[model samples]
Target: MPTLVVAVFLAFFAAEYAVETGLLLLNLRRARRSGDAVPAPLQGVVTPGSAARSRDYTLANGRLALVSGAWSAALTLAVLLSGLLPWLHQALAARGLAGAHRFVAFLVLVSAPFWVAGLPFALYRTFVLEARFGFNRTTPALWLKDRAKGLLLSAALGLPLLYAVYGFMALTGRAWWLWLAGFLTGVQILMVWLFPTLIAPLFNRFQPLPEGPLKERLEALARAARFRSRGLFVMDASRRSGHGNAYFTGFFRPRIVLFDTLVAQMTVPEAAAVLAHEIGHYQKRHVHRRLALGVAGQVVTLWALSLLVPWPPLYRAFGFAAPSYEAALALFSLGGGAFTFFLAPVASWLSRRHEYQADRYAVALVPEPGALASALVKLNRENLANLDPHPWYSAWHYSHPTLVERLRAIGEAGRPA
Candidate 1:
């Protein structure tokens, strides 16, 4: 049984790697085939130079992804099959640590290798690849500071949550999974509520949008759509990268945050159109719908874990000497992606659908129907986004429709009935 489990794990792992590599290669080939010419829909929207730059950027990032993915898979497979986990568990046991302490320590130690291994790739991407495209603004000192803060924050927040999970598993008997799932769901909600106010400030400064025409325009647009929010704010996103985005955070008292880069690049109408699109997400109840689906996913995951946590063969297949919740959790965290990779297209499809609905809603609310389309084009050009991607690749990977598709939809939405 243990051998069979290992075989199945290896098969899934290999299949997922092959599929991901294939999709990336296909996308890169499609980009290459597009040459330097701008697509017909975007002929005048963006220059040929911008189109060529976007293609090069796509190929650069895709190559990096291919290398990074292979490295990660190799590292994970080595750790899983090398008997390292069992040895580490035994070493910790010999030190007289048990229960939550042992589990937390084990998890931290196991994760350290992956973290260290990934640092070079992160650095190269930020300093080399992104910088080459004129997007990276993160200095080395800032990068190091951010990494340190992230690690500390993870320890501060993750440790308590992990300990609580262990406590429930130890104390709640067979119903532990149910209790843990409910507790985690509550935590998720609390994090959502607190993130905008408490967590986000740790990394970037956010300030209310100045009392100006843009603010008034956005406020009016929100009012017209009957969408209520805490307020409009701008984030200092250019501190790290030249990329621009806008999002709303928090379940209650949600605040609309626009990247300063975005604000600087867009006109009043375009910015208002962007805000309207964000408001459309709320008006259409996309946020609540996604949250509900996420909670359901959590419940299902916890239920599945309950069934697997006590299965001796699972632990044995992963080099553990005995069945243990901590071991099972670790193994699942490492290997679950092999099975979940198949679900990416489903998630991507739902997200794209939401984006289209939001776009339509924005067109209905904004004074200038073309503002959103123009904003989208400018965003793609400025961000150097892949203007054309393989259909299969986009369907499987993109959370939003490609630029051409979006422009076509917006144009159709604007036409007479």
Candidate 2:
């Protein structure tokens, strides 16, 4: 029965990959034929030069994704079908480590190889592709510094978090998954509070928005939404890429962060519109809804892991001599994507729905609907977004609606695109 289940899992995994890769290839072909001419919808939004550049950019990234995704997927599958998990578990166990210490150490060791394998690809993407397109602002030293910070932070936070989780599991037995889900759900919410003040500063400098019209407009919007924003801030996002964006960070007191590049490029009103859109997300309770969905997903996942982890043949399928939490963790972390890819479309749909609601709320706050649409257009151009993604591809992968879809929604709200 376990072997049958494993076989079924592999089949589902294969089918999921096939569907995802098929859409990717379709999109790639669509992009190749996309041409240098700007579409009518984006005619005023992006210039011909920018459109041509976006085509090239999308193609380059698509090819990179294809090759890199294949490579990583192959690596993961090889490890699962081989006895690598069991071998690694034994090697770590031989170190006389036990419980959470053993598990965290095992994860670190196993993930290190893949992380190292990926460094060259990461370097190429940042230094070569992004640089070719004039997007790379990261110096080699900065890149290295970022990586080191991430590694240190991972150890700093992840070690203690995993230890507590394992401790709960030991205490709860069959109900460990429930305990874990509850603990992690709290942590997820807590991180939103901690991120703006604690974790983000480690990577990029976040300075308060200088007092001016822009600051005044944002605060006004926050007040209109009845949200006492923590504050409005500017992020030094130009250190890495040319992309411009704005977002709300933290939970209790959500501060608005506009990329310095975004501020530099767009007008103050457009910037206000963009911030309105972000604040709209908070006002419409989108963040809370997303957190709820994430928590629900985590609960389901932990429950699934509980049922699957103890099965002997599932581990044997991965060459584990016996069941080990460390081995199970590694398998799930590495291989679970293949099992869950089917949910992409559903998740994308939910996100797109939320975005429409947020867009409506943004217009309600900003009044000039075109300002939001115009801001969206400027962002699309700046980010080199694909103007006309295939419907299935968009459904599968797009968290937000495309420029066309968004403009249509805005038009419904009397925003002329």
Candidate 3:
């Protein structure tokens, strides 16, 4: 039976677009509802009765929405058109004009331009708009250097994987999902292993924590949470942005990285509160849960792609010349992207749940709910994060609970255990 692949692709896109736009509108309304109830510290950052300042924030959000929407649309179109290159390769093979591997190489070459198109917008958003907001400390030179490094690194690691995927689809099309899943899982494991030592240093500088009250408090919090980290390292995040963040990255080679921006302004107790949240993620097993969800999602997607690729109308629906291994890849990408668009809300909901769970774990372990609340307020103020995002927006895009929500949760947890 000929599958209406193009129709599936369009349906997927429409579903995603509707859900995303709806979520954004919901968040915008929530932001409006929060009104003057924004955390006290955040009020000082917004100049009261300053029309220009208000306009700037609104404009930035609008720009973010526009860029995000356009990006999704453009990439969808690229994936649909990509089927053309694969079809050409198939025709060449029929004429004995190219070997199978050459066709694979040609398909890979054709996809590079589409892959690179997103880079400029990403750079501009981080270096230009973020800089204008007094959030970026990264020099243009440093930004470009980092970008180049990322591209080279991705190509070095990803190219061979792509070739392997192509070979798997061509040779083991029936059980290709299992093979592809194993390969993908292996790559993920390798990346996790390399991230701390090889990947992270290419962007940020990490140093052992300085001797200070903050360090002592953090150690105490870590002990309370029953966690052990290799070292407390401070990252030079302030050089690139004013955003304050702390994360626990690396699995086997675990490290705790505090952004310099975080440490510079936060009090010792506040810093400890932040560290508690990171440790809470580990203590609650949120990382493992997230990984499980990711792997499951990948397996489902691979299985779906395997089914869709063998159907002939999928190629015709996308205006691809005929069914071929490479054509199947392009179709899968297009259709899969569309499908994931609607799936965003489901994933976002799960993520927000995990974040709330981690917050609960933090409050339970540290019993410093007040400090955690204060830290949340400070982080929102420093980062210029929207204190009053529409509830719908927060539900759809926010992985973490809103600052107010988090503080409220902390307050609720203040009861004697």
Candidate 4:
């Protein structure tokens, strides 16, 4: 490898890890010092004691992320430096697995170690940190079962898709990325269409929103928005964690799913407000906008990868042998993080903007914004969110606005009843 190539890669590599570590620690300190008192905006809305617990929860998660991030980064750095990819490529080549089959085998072989390696961290997060905070609901046996299902799910869907991509790459010559991009775009659409009915039920049970005031209110809210759906359902999400959430799923029609824990704690109006906010995402086209942006990104990245895969120097810079699709995917997967690390703020900004837009739509739909504001506070307290994070760190990490910001935005919204 040329000294310059190695130097550039290492520089970006080290910088990415350093930036992540800094953000984690900075947010941790900010949360710790934010104190136990609720910010004035939430003074009447949120209890003071909840703020302290939220800080503790943030701290716990920050600590976990710091450790896990460092461990994973170190593991990745070691693997790249240790020349593992080339060895794997040679072993598979010796077996004479050609075209799509080779990529499929490579995907499975490389993914297994990563999967097993992450098991300990997953276990620790669920059994230790989350349990300490009273959020964990998953058992050890259930965890293993989930992992097994995940592996099966990945193999069932991922292999065939990858097979087609590699096959098209070899057959169609230079335009393989365009073909792969279209193929991937189709897969993304398929998943969205099927996830609500076919895939989601594989892990959690989903039942029709039980007949009650909450259901009646949610149905009314849906009707007001003129959104059609498979009807509302309650997911047994609390079976795994105490954290509560609600979302819209499905490609053609909307499927509103509420976590059981969310329903249990929130008042009827507050629950209705939450669902309104979710429905707003659909009504406002935020979901489709995101999907379009993501598909575009895939197309661009695949096009770039098609250009890079034939370059031997790029592989040698990372201590790999001559270029192959499997090697290109592995290298790109490992190295893409470093190159895109700086784009974190931009992505977060877009997401937060979408969130605020959705929030405005909710305010317009609901009778009042107070219920959504109150619901946000309850969610912040229950989920142990960092009420105040350093602006820089939040810009890089937070998808939604801080509670204070959202409350202010909600107050400012003058949308008609």
TM-score of each: 0.98, 0.96, 0.87, 0.96
**For model 4, what is the error of residue 352's alpha carbon versus the real structure, in angstroms, after optimal superposition?**
0.8
**What tens-digit string does per-residue lDDT give for candidate 3 at 1-417?**
235555556677777777777676666555455544534644554443332333355457656776767786767676565565555565667767554565466566556766677777777788777777777788889888987898888788767877788777777758989888888987887888788778899888999999988788888877766788888999998777888998988664369999998998788877887787787788778787888888888888888888877677776766666666666775566456665665666787888777777777766666554777778777866776666566666666778877667766777877777
Q: Per-residue lDDT for 1-417 in model 2, tens only? A: 557756877887788778978998998888888788787876766788888888899899989988887888788777777767777788878989888888778878888879887998999999999999889999999999999999899889888997887787667889999999999988888888899899999998999999988888777877877888777789999999999988888766787888999999888778878877787788778888888899899999989888777878778776778887777777788777768888889999999998998888778778664898889888888889988777889999999998989988888987344
Between candidates 1 and 3, the one scoring higher on TM-score is: 1
**Local lDDT at 65 for model 1:** 96
**In model 1, where is the ten-residue run with the lowest total lDDT?**
317-326
| lDDT-based ranking | 1, 4, 2, 3
Put down candidate 1 lDDT per residue, 1-417, tens digits, no spaces: 999999999999999999999999999999998989898988888899999999999999999999999999999998899999899999999999899999889888989999999999999999999999999999999999999999999999999988999999889999888899899989988988888888899999999999989988888888788778898889999999999999999765588999999999999999998888888888888999998998888888888888998899998887788977678888888998898899999999999999999999899888786999989988998899999899999999999999999999998988889
lDDT at residue 216 of model 1 (Cα atoms): 87
Provide the lDDT at 227 for model 3. Answer: 83
Q: Of the candidates numbered 1 and 3, which has the greater lDDT value?
A: 1
Q: Cα RMSD to native, each candidate?
A: 1.0, 1.9, 3.5, 1.7
lDDT (0-100) at residue 95 of candidate 1? 99
Candidate 2 residue pairs that clash: none
Task: Name the better of 2 and 4 by lDDT.
Answer: 4
By summed lDDT, the worst window of 10 consecutive residues in model 4 runs over 1-10
Best by TM-score: 1
In Å, residue 73's CA in model 1 sits off its true spot by 0.4
User: Which TM-score value belongs to model 3?
Assistant: 0.87
- In the range 1-417, model 4's lDDT, one tens digit per residue, is 445766877899999998989888888888878889787877876776888888888898889888888888878877777877778878888999877888889877876777777888888989999999999999989888988898899889888877887787788888988887888888888888889888889999999999989888888988898978888999999999999999888765878899999999999999988988888888778888889989888988888888788988888876666778888888788877788789888889999998998888888888964889889988988898888888889999899999999988988885444
CA lDDT scores, all candidates in order: 0.91, 0.84, 0.72, 0.85
